[model samples]
Structure formats: C-alpha cells, structure tokens
Target: MSTGGGAHAAGLIRLLQSADFARAFTLAALGTGFASLLIGRTAGSVTLVTIVIALDVVGAAILFARRDELTLLRFAPTSLLAFLAWTLASTFWSFDRASTLRGWFELLAWGLLAIVIAHVRDTLQTVRALGDVMRWMLAISLGVEILSGILLDIPFPFLGVAGDIAFGGPIQGIFGTRNMLGFVAVMALITFTIEWLSQSISLRLSIFSLTLAALLAVLSASPTVLVIAVAVGAATLALALVRRSAPEHRRTTHTAIGAVVATVLIVCWFLRHLIIRLLDAASDFSIRADLWNEILDWVRPRPVQGWGWHGPWLRGDDASAPYPLNVINFTLDDRHASALNSFFDVLIQVGWGGLLLFGGMSVVAVVRSWLVAGERRSIVHAWTPLMLVALLVDSMFESFTLTGLGWMMLVVCAVRAGQSRSWRERIRDLAEGAPGGHGSGSSQDPLSGAR
Candidate 1:
C-alpha cells in the first residue's frame, strides 16, 4: 500500500513537470484570460475568480517543481518587477485599501500565469499555444454572432451581443464589446499570420484562421481596428525589410524605418482631425477626449503618487469604493469603467511614478524584442515585436493592457524578450568568463522553432 501511494505521487509529479503538461497549461491560461469576460458573464465573477485561483495554484506548483532548473535572476524583467512592486506599494496610500489590494492581487495572478508560460515554453511554443486559443475563440465568436444575429435575430444581453451581424455588425461576440472583439480579432490575425509563416499549422487551417480573423475584425466595426490594422501592416512591412537586409545594412535599415515611422506619426498627429473624419472616429474620439479631460482633472490632484492602484473602477458599490473613480464617474455623469487609455489609467492609478515605470517596461520590452527579431534568422522571432507594437499602439485607445489578457501578453512578450537579450545574460557570461556571451547560437535561439 505504501509503495503504491508513493508511485502514484511520483507519477503525478512527473506528469505536472512534463512538456506536454506545460503546453496544455499555457493554452488554458491564455484561454481563461482572453475569455474572462465571457466566463464572468456566463458563470459569474465567483467562477472566474475560482478558475484563476486554480490556475495560480497549478502554476505555483509547476514553478516550484522546476525551481532547481530556474534561477531568480532570469525569472522576469527588472522593469516588470519594479512596476509590480510599485503597484503593491501603493496599497499603503490607496484610497480604498481593500480595492487596491484586490487589484494588485489580480494583477499578480495574471502576471504569474504569464511568467510560468514564459519559463516553461519557448517563444514558438507560446505562439502556437496562442494560435490554438485564438482560433477557437474566433470561431466561437463567429458562431455566437451568427446565432444571435442571423438565426435567432435577437440580442444576447447576457453576452452583451447586440445581434448586429445581420445589419453589417458592430458585433461584440463573447468579448462584451465591439472594441474588445476587435482587439481579439487583431490578435488572432497576428497569431494566425505567425502560424502560417512558421508552418506550425496546416496551410488550409491557417487560411481559415486568417479569414476568420479578418472577417470578425471587419464585422466588429471598431474604429480602433482601423488604426491597429494600419500600424500592424506597416510594422509587418518594416520587419520584413529588416529581416531581408544584409547584416551590415540592417542598422541603416532600422534607422531609416524609425525615421519614417516618426515622421508618419507626426504627420498623423497634425492631421488628426482629417484622419478622424476619414475613419468616422470623430464621435469616438470626442467621447474619449471628454473622459480624458475629466481623468486629467482627477490626475492633477495626485500628480506624483496618484490615488493608488485600483485597476478597473469599482462598480455597483459606490459607498465602499475609492474617492476619485466614483467621484469621476459621478462628475462625468457616466459610469466610466476606466480612463479608456492605459497610460492615463496608469497615471491615475499609481501617479507619475507608476506611469514612468509602466513606460520604461513597455519601451524596454519592445526595444529588446525588436532587436532580437531583427538579428534572429527565424520567422517566429518576428512575432514578439509585432505583437508588442500592436499592444502598445492599442494601449493608447484602451485600458486593456492594465489588466487581463493584454497584461498577460505584455508580460509574456517582455519575459521572452528578456530571455533572448538581457543584462542577466551578460552578467552570467562574465561570471563564467565567456567573453561576449553566446552569439546568436542555437542555445540563444531556443525560440527559433524548426528552422
């Protein structure tokens, strides 16, 4: 009996540490975070929390089991850790300690999940996992839209879907809003494109996935989608050029691309009104502008340290809520869930200090990823930089990056980027007396799958 019990325990431990198990867990975590709104709405917040807690427990166990092989130095990005630490520190000064603590805990939960996936799987594996999740998510979203709009011809209030597909939709699908759906579709498009490029999935499936993503992205009718599409398309072209350039000329290519992007952005900013009208995003921008104005009014009072890190605005319980969010909502005469801008959201939450930390984290992550992608020979290397571009550009329009799936993706990309190029690697190489460290070898290119 004792032998049997020991054998069973050993089996369980081995199973948990297996590569297949890690991939599966990655899929589950991505799916949960991406589908959080649908889960929360359908199964209730309690169920959503329960699922997250369960995943957290499993992630902790897996990390613990693998602790011998993993070092703290290489665990996460320094900037990411600093930002998290600042957010945690904000609890002391937060308007509502309870809410702040909850927000911080949720933030840690998603971050942990991302960290685990980053440690367990390489970039290509992570991308493939994301591809699987996005495919299912996009398919189900289309199915739901069809059911609500074409077949039933009624709104799915439970899912926040307005059955608008029949009328050339602004369909929400399961993401709770057109903007969210559009965001997911864009992410899917990126993932599917990577999958196709990497030859990870069948050509037929890749084609279907791309078609599905494009279809939903259009049907969502999100103005943000247009901007994201243009940014991502331009980025794709730039990355392709960088990849094809000779090693010596790559730096020149990078500089030229940077200058062009900057000039384009400046031009867009100056012609913002014309572009807004062209995209029919005037009303959306106007609404966002008004809310941003109100948010600035709140941010002025707590410029340095802000009102503490209460993520999404507290809903339903005004009395128990923090000062500025409830106050802002009342003042605006609208129940604004967030500042609608991630930078502003961070600024309002943890103040200037937090915003700086957040900005540093983003910039470092993107720069590292971009450099790695440019130097690496594999197509999969391009995924991180492209996704980072999408996320950062989208952050200007939505607060999604502060929490949930967006936050997870950001952390995963940052960790992957750091793994490929970081101070930690330099220090380790110096310690081992290996000058210049390993240079673009197979060891360094762990993410370079199949190629």
Candidate 2:
C-alpha cells in the first residue's frame, strides 16, 4: 500500500512538471487564494484546502530542488520560522494544547503555500503569480455580489451577506463582510496599478481591473479599506518621486521624507477622533477597545511569554480555567472582535519575546525587498515591497499578521524581497533566460509557464 501511494504521488508530481500540464500552477494558485480568501471554514472546504495545500507542497518541493541550497534560506525568514517554532512550543504550556496544535498546522499550511510562490526566479514573476490569482478572485467576488444583490433580489445568507444589488451595495459577496471585500479591492487596485506601471499587462486589461477595483471600493463602503487605498496611493506617489530624483540628491530626498512623515504623524495624532469620524468607525469599534483592555490586563502578569499561544480561551463556564484573554464567549461560532490591532495580537499570543521577533522579521522583509526592487529596476519589483508595507499598514486595524491571505502574502513578499544573490548567480539567471541557455529548468523560473 505504501509503495502504491508513493508511486501515485510521484506520478502526479511528474504530471505537474510536464509541459502539457503547465496550467497546473494556475489551478493551484487559484485554489490557494480561494481557500484562504473566498471560502469560509466548512468541513468540505477545509478538506479541499488541505488537499490543495498538500498538492502545493509537492509542487514546491519540485521547484525547491532547482535552486542552490544556500539560497533556500531566503525563502523562510529567521523571525517567521522562529515565531512558528515558538507558537508550536507554546503548546506545551497552553491549557488547550490540542487547539494550539491544530492552529499551528493551519498557520503553517498558509506559510508553506507562500514559500511555493517565493520559488520564482525573480520578483516580477512572483508579482505575476499574485496578479493572476487576484484577478480571478476579485472578478468572481464582484460577480457573486451582483448575483446576490441584483438578480436574486436578496441577501446571500449562505455567504453571510446582506445588502441591495445596487452599485453602492451593502453586499458582502463571498467574503461575508463589506470590509473584507473592500480589503481585497484595495489590494486589487495595488496589483492593477503596478501592472499598468510595469507594462506587465495590456492597457485595456489594466484599465478593466482598475475599474472593477474602484467600483468595489465604492460599493463596499469600508472605511478601513478606503484609508488603505489612500495610503497605497501616497506610498506609490512617494516611490515615484524618489525614483525620479537625481542619484546625488538621495540624502536630500531622505530628509524630505522624514519631515513629511513627522508632519503627517503630528497631524494624525491631534486629529485622531476626526480621522475615526471620517471613516464612520463605531464609537467603541465593535468592542475592540473593551477586548484590548481585557487583553492588556491579562498580559500584565506574564509580560515575557504570556498564556502560551492560547486560542479562544475558557471555552466553557468553568471558573477555575483561565478566562479568555479577549473577554469573549468562546462557545460562539462567530467572532466579531479581536485585539483589532496586529501588534497587540502578537503581544497577546506570544508576549514580548514573540513581538520583538515578529518586528525584526517585518523590518528585514521590508528593507531587503526595498533594496532588491532598486537592483532589479523593475517597477513590479518596486511594487512588491509596497505589498508588504500595505499589509503592515492594514494590520494596524485588523490584526492580519497571522493566518489567512494577508499572512500568506507577507510570507511571499518577504521571501522575494530579502533575496541575496551573487554576481555568478545573476549571470546564471540571465543565461537561463537566453535562447541557447539551459532554458526553463525547474530550478530557474519554472513558474513562467504562463509567460
């Protein structure tokens, strides 16, 4: 039985590697996106995502064999791996050890999928994969909303959506919430904008994508999404201006940026309430403040290591058990509140030690990716780093640092941005792209099947 299973697995992998099955990458990529973003957790969906992730692991393993052993470390950041290790280690101390173990596997599966995306020979290819996956996701999501609100003339109760089918829809589509739709739309805007700037896709295609993204942004009516869109625009404009600056004027450019940042921070600090008002945020932001206070109170005792990555604590009414850190009834299937801040989320789950590690990971990913973008001189590469920046910014409101699509995207960006290749390796990549070179090997640019 074991031999037969192994043989079947090998045969499947070989099929994926074959030229005729080149579209296999697209199918796998779309599955990863849908499993993480479009579909919610159900027994059937869970089984599907698990199988898709398993297949993705096989594909990743095949691609991993092509790169130099040393370069493989670039695919997994030290902080990220450490965080995962720590999270797993916490199971030893956690009251709900079984739950912690399950959560760890779930999180690691997403990380593995990201590593697969990072297998690309260049950041441009990585971005291309992202664009392809998102194009389908956003397009289908919009279609679902239209179907629910317009043709059906009712909410998609199954999807947990409620709203009219009008352009400014309250519709949640397949994402189950307007804010989630808004978040995806903003990301789509970023992807499409970069595709336009890099000339990676045709003008018509880019315009169409932009139109869909903009329309969704308006319809979703998510304050956080709109804020993120503005931030993305600001970041893009800033990158463009810096890109156009004379090489010798970099020092001056840095100084100007610092001043601008300082001014913006000061203005935001004084007008914090006004900012919240503009976004139509709830006065208490749906109990986030209350939850944050509870978390902080509980975290005071174990400032260093805290409750051992405990998940949805105190599921029952037993008083002896540690109360949920977030002050919620764990028995409830739907959770409407979180720490609502990513930094706090880390601090709550992993304590101060985990917080520092995550911070280091974020810093290394951003700085390294920024440097590589400059080296490649590809606008898409430049755009790649921005994705991480945008994720970090988005994290400020929604605790998106771990699990799901945001987490996976951060992992992909980190692997691509922080790569360090020698001159010999650079020459090899150029040669590999040449007509007569070892053309299109698995180790170098295997995912360019679409291109």
Write down the worst ten-residue block by lDDT for model 1. Answer: 442-451
Writing each residue's lDDT as its tens digit, candidate 2 over 149-260 gives 7778677666766746575765565666776678777777887888888888999988988898888778887778867877777767766676677767855875787599
> Which one is best on TM-score?
1
TM-scores for every predicted model: 0.95, 0.82
lDDT score for candidate 1 against the true structure: 0.88
lDDT of each: 0.88, 0.65
